[model samples]
Target: MSVMTISEALHEALRGEMLRDPKVFTIGEECGFDGLYGVSTDLEKEFGDKRVIATPISEAGFVGMSVGAAMRGMRPVAELMYIDFIGVCMDQIINQAAKMCYMTGGQVSVPMVLRLPMGSGRRNAGQHSQNLESLLTHIPGLKIVAPITPCDAKGMLTAAIRDDDPVVMLEHKLCYNIRGEVPDGDYTVPFGKAAVRREGTDVTLIGWSRQVLNALEAAEILEKEGISAEVVDIRSLVPLDFDTIAASVSKTGRAVVAQECVNRGGYGGEISAQISENLFGALKAPVVRIGAKNIVPPFAHTLEDAFFPNTADIAAAVRKMMREEGSACG
Candidate 1:
């Protein structure tokens, strides 16, 4: 066992995987140097320049190259510096990497991992701070995982690299430095399994990545007000564990889904719909969704705080849901 931040855990996972597998290699801007968030630092020194390849500042070109490399049996971990840059490589990701295997009748697999650092709270403005996991989830043939804990950040990356499919790792910028316990050595947390951070009977708080941390904090606040809120860390979105969400929502009789993205047409809408459709009979009230304000994220620190949803927003949503449904706060 080891105490590690999410950044360190990811670095350890990549290092461990590269040591274990000959096909594994990483490529991205500055990855061969110190990486965008320090997760890939010191790797080039250990692996050499060829394996820890750095590319030109071209998202489309490098990502296309990575897809071609994956098709040729090389396991590449390609990092797109920001989630906001996805638009520049949409064709390479959505059309080529995602559709190649199915279009070829399972004859080929793009066994690559795309590490995209996302979310706000860093005052990166609208261009660099957008949360687009909701948009990515809509695409087919892509596996998306957003692990909040250092353990999952490490374990799931291992699993993503090993899986014979293209996986998109939605790593939040704010979560990189948060410390947590991580199992030492090689380990993989299976995708589609949601972790229950806290057990409660009143309502379920479902979130992924850094939003899970917000949910946990909200649960603590809700507890003080006599409301028991279960915190469900949705580890992955592509192979979503709707069953686990259903179980929690069923037990609690209510649910509140959250996302760091804007409220309009965000991923929370999909989760809320799923619960309403499958667990409709068990639901005591309509599932509430908490999301950032439907507007471009502001650059100012205070405006950014107001633009995004926080722990208070989550707790208040839960309170509103219970109150409107005539349910007890406790």
Candidate 2:
């Protein structure tokens, strides 16, 4: 194993997958060069234009082309510079790539991956800084995965490329520079699996992508207050590992789900509802959700910090949940 940043691990994964499968190619804007967040840096230099094809600033056009290529049995990894731009190509992604396989009575498969750089903390403002994974998770045909660490970033990307259906891989911009130990050579992390980052009995903290790191940090802080918080990372959202989350909540008797997206319709709410529905008797308190405010991501750093849920917010949510005596009545 070698220690590397999430960016480097992603680059290594793309490089390895391209070499392993001649049909696997990447198509997106600025991907042929250094790429946004350095995940595709030096990829085109090694693989050339045929494999690492660069396109114009047309999200709908290029993504439509990627879907067509995937239908023809070619694995295309399309990069959307930001998750916010998904609106420009919703028809291609939600309608075409997602529905083709099922529409053809399972005779055809779209083995494609859409890589998106998401989340806030950078001053990218309202347009560029948004976590829209919840939108994709709502779609029936699409699969969603968010890697919090370098190891999973590499492994999950490899797995997404090899899968038969279209997968949306959400990479947090803040996690690109974070370093961790990643295994050498080709490997894949299976979907519908949850990784327990910390073990405890007091309360369960669940999150994905950068929010997982925040949950981990919150667990550490809660430890000082005599609260043993267990942290679970929901790596894949679509084929969600509800079993792991239910098990954790059952063990802890309380749960607090956190995410960087707005609270109203965030995926964290779905997690909370699932826990409540499946493990109501096991819960000592209502499942709380910690998420960003119901407002656009602000440009100012101070406002941005307040808008997004932080380590303190997670810890506080857990504390509130623990204070309850039994499951909340509807």
Candidate 3:
């Protein structure tokens, strides 16, 4: 019940975990001194170089080291700076960390966490900004968790660290400063569970990361217009809580899945498809998706604004769904 920025909450979570567990250690580029966004600023001073190790600008090598270290009982958390850089270490993440358990017949556990800053609202251009959670989610045995609020960030991160499987924690670039109440004591939000941020009977809006914030704003606007929009923040994408999403859509009869990722082959597509398959009879209209136009995020602020889905776009989508529902009933 304490108000804190998302960054502070996450930092608190890391700090608490490191204190509670001796094996937990974090490694990344500039995460020690630079701390990039300052989430890991005081970490180096408190934990020292042995625990908060900074590495060269080599994703592949460091990621491999993390996996190797995790196999030897170290809870190594590797930060990739931006998610786009994951491509450089795909072999480590995909062939190694992900399949280690199966390859070793459950004798080995890759208890490692890969933290990456993601999303495209900061004009970080095409390479720096991108929601590639869906890509990571595609790989089996890799647990993907993306938290939108301070509470979930702390809770989910703690859970990810304790998990025996490889976890890819994607932190939204724009959600770092979002303020929310976080519990004082230790807490853990289970993975594969979706939390309904706001409930409504008219329509369901599914989003993650910064899009969840955008969806909430749109929900407020829709509420004023008599469109009760339910907002669902998907904390985990891999072990998806589609049941909760389906339940919400069942009651609402309409859905608008949104994300900062591009339209084609995005995670929204998976949700929409699953909902249509499971809740086909209950759906009043086809599930609609609001996302970045299928183009690389531009560097210019205006172009970026035009590319990413905003509150206005979400409101319009909800309005359209409402209109369609009304037409169908009449």
Candidate number with greatest lDDT? 1
Best by TM-score: 1
Candidate 3 has its poorest 10 consecutive residues by lDDT at 32-41
The superposed Cα distance between candidate 2 and the true structure at residue 5, in angstroms, equals 0.7
* Ranking 1 against 3 by lDDT, winner: 1
In model 3, the Cα lDDT at residue 99 comes to 99
Candidates sorted on lDDT, descending: 1, 2, 3
Better structure of 1 and 3 per TM-score: 1
lDDT of 3 by residue, 223-297 (tens): 998888899988889899988998899999899999888889888999999999889999889999888888888
TM-score of each: 0.98, 0.97, 0.97
- Per-candidate count of clashing residue pairs (backbone under 3 Å): 0, 0, 0
Q: Is candidate 1 or candidate 2 better by lDDT?
A: 1
Which sections of candidate 1 miss by over 4 Å?
327-330
lDDT tens digits, residues 55-152, model 2? 99999998999999999989999998999999999999999999998899999999999999998988999999999988889999999999988999
lDDT of 1 by residue, 46-101 (tens): 99988898988899988998999999999999998899999999999999999999
lDDT for predicted candidate 3 compared with the true structure: 0.89
Model 3 spans > 4 angstroms off: 325-330
User: Each model's C-alpha lDDT?
Assistant: 0.92, 0.91, 0.89
